[model samples]
Target: MHQERLTKLRNASPAVLPSLLQCDFGDLRSEVERLQAAGIRALHLDVMDGHFVPNLTYGMPIVAGLRKLTDLPLDVHLMISDPAAYVDDFAAAGADMLTFHIEAVPEPAQLIQQIHSHGIVAGVALNPQTPMEALSGCLDQVDAVLVMSVNAGFGGQAFDPEAVQRLQQLRQSHPELLLEVDGGIKPETIGPCHQAGCDLFVVGSAIFGQDDYAAAVRQLRDAL
Candidate 1:
């Protein structure tokens, strides 16, 4: 059933920035509106903490506020140490897709189960240093796998060349699973990622920090 749902999202209307990362919390409503107007179908929310990733991002208030900004789907990625502790909060905050790192939580499979219980798509994120094999026995419950190309915590980092081969390996092992690529996902790198079987592309500073947000989305989409 989860697989079927993911397939539906993949086949949705093609447009600019299928995955638009909203890192700048400044004027949350305005930014969300601009992203939606720019033809971004899905919004990627990066949740961080000073612990796991050396960064501190907003929590429930931002999520609650952004919920009213646009009707577009929200993709929440938790880069915190204790992911399960905030599962219910994020779920109640209106996240359509919740992805927590596989290496952070104590019981990842159980966390996925709890996320599912909340009626949202549950996904797992693997850091740049983490092996792809870490997702081994827990693939079935996951709706997606977020492979971090840069060390998490901040944006605008270089896209790792080694990630390409690793992405290919993930594609080979899990054809049914939706693979997502995050961190430093610029226009030129998108093609190879798609070719390597990454269905979802999460771009943060590439779009948010641009002169024209809408144009950035178009450039990323057209390049891919």
Candidate 2:
């Protein structure tokens, strides 16, 4: 099942995944409906623990809630201190993919195996300041790698030009890996990231902050 979903995502290469963190949680179902109508292929969920990133976002309940709302792939980003402990919980909550911060894990390969054990795609994420060398041992083992364009915790930060370099390096080294870019992914910055080698763009404010979600998505796609 997980492989099928991953294949579906790969088929829609360079897909736009609207971040739910910026959506109207008061009316989440409608927000999801709007995104689906706007032609989104997946949804990105940011789960942050206060200790790891100085911010607290939603947890399993929200994941489950979104699971109940739509069948679109749930790409859950775990920005926490200990993601291995929550692997089963998030997978049970219906996450199709679970990406944990490489900086937070001592045994990234083990954690990646743990996430895969749950029958879901596992990804490793690196913060803007983290060197690409940090992912050396586990790069080829995981299904995806999320290159943070900005710091992890916040929602509306500026895109870091360094992230494009990181994406390029990863693409050059591992051409088959799914490269995802998150944070500061508006029309102006997204094109360069895509050119550099990003298979998935996790956009937040660019779509949610707009009056017309469909138009916002179309504009971003046009930029790509």
Candidate 3:
């Protein structure tokens, strides 16, 4: 199941995954419909525990709700301290790809295998300041690597220039890895990241903040 989802994601490479964090929850179904109608390949959902990132976001309920809403792949990001504890819950909640922070887990290999056992794509994420070497042990084991261009706690933060360099290094070293960039991805900043070899972009405010979602997505695609 994970292999099939990974193939779908690869086919949609250089795609923008609109973050649900910036969407209007009251009209979530409509927001998702608009994005799908606009041709988004996937959705990015951030699950944050208050302790891990100093901010609390939605969990399984939201993921389960989204599963019923669209067939688009749900790229669930676990910004929590103990992602190992909830892998089963998120998998059952309908996450197609589960990405966890490397800083949060002491032994990522076990967690990666644990996630795969549930038949969902597993990914490792690196914060802005975390060096590439930190992922040396398990880089080849996961399906994707999410490069957080800003701090993980919040949305609408500025894109860190250092992330581009990190993307370049990863692209050069691990040519086949699925490289995703999150945070501050807008029309202007997205171009550079794409050039730097980012395959998937996690965009929040740039898509949802606009009145017309299609035009906003078009602008970002054009910028790419």
Query: Candidate 1's residue-wise lDDT over 1-224, tens digit each?
Result: 44444555566423234333355556666777777778787777788888998888777777777788766667788989998899899888988778898888635778888888877888888878887778886887788888889888866578897777877988898877777888778888887888787878888767877878889988888877
Q: Is 1 or 2 the stronger prediction by lDDT? A: 2
Could you tell me the TM-score of candidate 1?
0.90
For each candidate in turn, the TM-score is 0.90, 0.98, 0.98
Q: Which stretches of candidate 1 lie over 4 Å from their true place?
A: 1-8, 12-24
| TM-score between model 2 and native | 0.98
Q: What local lDDT does model 1 show for residue 72?
A: 65
1-224: candidate 3 lDDT, tens digit per residue: 87999999999998999999989899989989999989999999999999999999899999999999999999999999999999999999999999999999857989999999988988999999887789998888998999999999975577899999999999999998999999888998999999999999999888988999899999999999
**What lDDT score belongs to each candidate, Candidate 1 first?**
0.76, 0.91, 0.92
User: Runs in model 2 with CA error above 4 Å?
Assistant: none
- lDDT score, candidate 3, position 7: 90
lDDT of 1 at 25: 55
User: In candidate 2, what are the lDDT values of residues 104-205, reduced to their tens digit?
Assistant: 984687888888888898899999988788899898789999999899997658889999999999999999899999988999989999999899999988
Best by lDDT: 3
Ranking by lDDT: 3, 2, 1
